[model samples]
Target chain A: MKIPILRLERILLVSIQVDLTDNDAMQFQSDLVEQVAEIEALGVAIDITALDVVDSYMARVINDTASMVRLLGAESVICGVQPFVALTLVEMGRDLLGADCAFNLGQGLEILRTRIATRGDTRLSEDENV
Target chain B: MRMSELPPAQIPLHETADVVTARRAARELCEQLGFGKADQTRLATAVSELTRNVIQYANHGECVIENRSTATHRCIWVQVRDQGAGIANLEQALTDGYSTSGGLGAGLPGTRRLVDQFHIESTPQGTCITIVLTKPL
Candidate 1:
């Protein structure tokens, strides 16, 4: 298989823009295990919105991405996974506890917003005291 | 091999959880026919890939599963048929990485990988893919 070329950029001071689902086979490919480092923390978004079911390969990639981000001290959040894909994951018994994922765009943004805001709050309190 | 007509086993709908439903039926049948688990999964994956395509692409389809004990090996046969848009160039379509859609196009080739023998026939009316997996010597 040809390498899955990726485009990454900074967005909103948090979360990198990595468009994984646009063309070609539409999956992030089975090679994402090796490519997880590139998207760690403010990690790349894997769009599972179009897939009706999250197959075994996909579940592995997503899990791997999430774990990589956490290891790098950054949180990974998945966005736009459809309900059926979620169901399939549950049925197939994939655990995403070490990572974070959202069913919709709003939820993903909320995860980012919460993390960024919490960090900002900590910094603000430190400044006020010192 | 000459085409010898064999009785077709008509399975029920409770089995077709998706396109791969026939594979499950194949496993059950394989077990009953004394085929090993590993051998059963191989045949099941093959049948599943074909049956799934039939269900996903065709309005309706049926799985004809056959098991025959031979002198050399215990052989399993499966044919999944669907009355849908037949592939224009079936050979090319069966080629790896040649998808007409967002799918990875691994069904037919993957099916072939799982089985010892494979055959495909398609027309404007529909498609019929046959696969056979055999036990070890």
Candidate 2:
């Protein structure tokens, strides 16, 4: 239930939470993710660097988080991907192709900023239309 | 054998991810040692394939990695050895898509394509396959 978190910037952070425990057949822990949904504003970048991976639940969580964030009106991103971690995610065959991603933390935040800036321009236009 | 004479790592296969961990460890080492991104990718891919082979064929084994270089040419050798059944036909095993076991079938052969040199030796104790990645400057 306790997820290790690193606050990168205000309203944006990284959490090293278990996607799944070793005893469970599931590769990731859904219970922890549900806990993360409780926090307000910004987005949580789950640190998957420690996990070896199996099955697609975590991938589904990743997929769901993207939509989940949009519904919450918060920007989201995934970070800390090592080579094998990425490979296993791909091999598991999930619909992660559209997930906003970064090779590491630094890049992930940068991407989220870029997309958010683009949305800012759109918001300005919507205000003018209104 | 001296350090130079020893080949690439042959990691022990305790888990399915043993090879992946070892290979990633090596690639990290290379990055820490100051190799570029492309070099790390090639070496890591080669090691990953071999480790996957150990799991499929022997179920468990160890990885032995060697870093050997001379002047303009640097070669890293990795071998994934396992104490399981010896390969019956080395040539057939090397052939693309000819896996006796149902894996990607590309692990052994695909690893070969990723590196500069590749060799496999099988005995009752286990199989010692060496993959060499040479960077010529």
Candidate 3:
């Protein structure tokens, strides 16, 4: 299934609600990159809270997706990684480098806001700046 | 020992879709066996890794899931076997950051850490890996 990527202001929010196969993940990478470039988004938040399993292939795909977003000049954060998935990723020795992580969507948005502000992006207004 | 009498559910691992099926089956069986959410997720993720390996390196394979229960303990056992080119270096395959497929090399070792018991037997003719996860009493 194709994952939905929602656009809010200058941020793209992606919530994965299925057990993604290798093909699904590959498609997601391309789709996300394309969307990020199309809208010129300043930040991306990928929420995997509904995912119960993350294998080596999926982990690598997540890392690659984050890198692709950064290369496109958009900051990305991986949000809502469950405790089990976190433990498995560590055990597998596959760290999601170059991608910021948060406990949940709220934290993820905060990080993205800070990053966008630091980069002098137009997403956050002066009144909302923290 | 008690579970030896029951037939194991066989899942064919021939493609990426099969890997997803296997993972789903594992989670269902884990839930049926009364494993907690964390344990269920752990088992399902381990199953995903092994089944993906079967499809990636071995071309095709099968995963057998069985329930094992004794007087004081109950657990699930999974066996993944493939008839293809076997791993050249078992130790190297188990090491993190060592991958022949340009991956993170976390499949085998990560699987081992997720379960309560792990064993492997490989040869040029085929390879068989077994893992067991026991429910805490």
lDDT of each: 0.55, 0.58, 0.86
Model 3, residue A63: distance off in Å is 1.1
**Where does candidate 3 clash, by residue pair?**
none
Interface RMSD for every prediction, one decimal? 11.1, 7.9, 1.5
Evaluate residue A16 in candidate 1 and report its C-alpha lDDT on the 0 to 100 scale. 20
For each candidate, give its TM-score against the true structure.
0.50, 0.50, 0.91
Ranking by DockQ: 3, 2, 1
Model 3 stretches astray by more than 4 angstroms: A94-98, A123-130, B1-6
**Model 3: per-residue Cα lDDT over B7-93, one tens digit each:** 778998888999999999989888877788888888898899898989988999999998886667778999999998998999999
Q: In model 1, what lDDT does residue B67 have?
A: 64
RMSD in Å for model 3: 3.4
- Chain B TM-score for all candidates, comma-separated: 0.81, 0.79, 0.93
lDDT of 3 by residue, A44-118 (tens): 999999988887788889988998999999999999988987876776565733367999999999999988888
Give the alpha carbon lDDT tens digit for every residue of B21-112 in model 1.
45556777777767765566556555655665665577577888876656666677777787889988888877775656545455566556
Note the DockQ of each predicted structure: 0.05, 0.07, 0.66
RMSD in order of candidates: 13.2, 8.6, 3.4
Model 2 lDDT per residue over A1-117, tens place = 344455444234545544332223122334434444554445555455654432233344455656666566667777765665565444423343356777777677777666767
Docking class of 1: incorrect
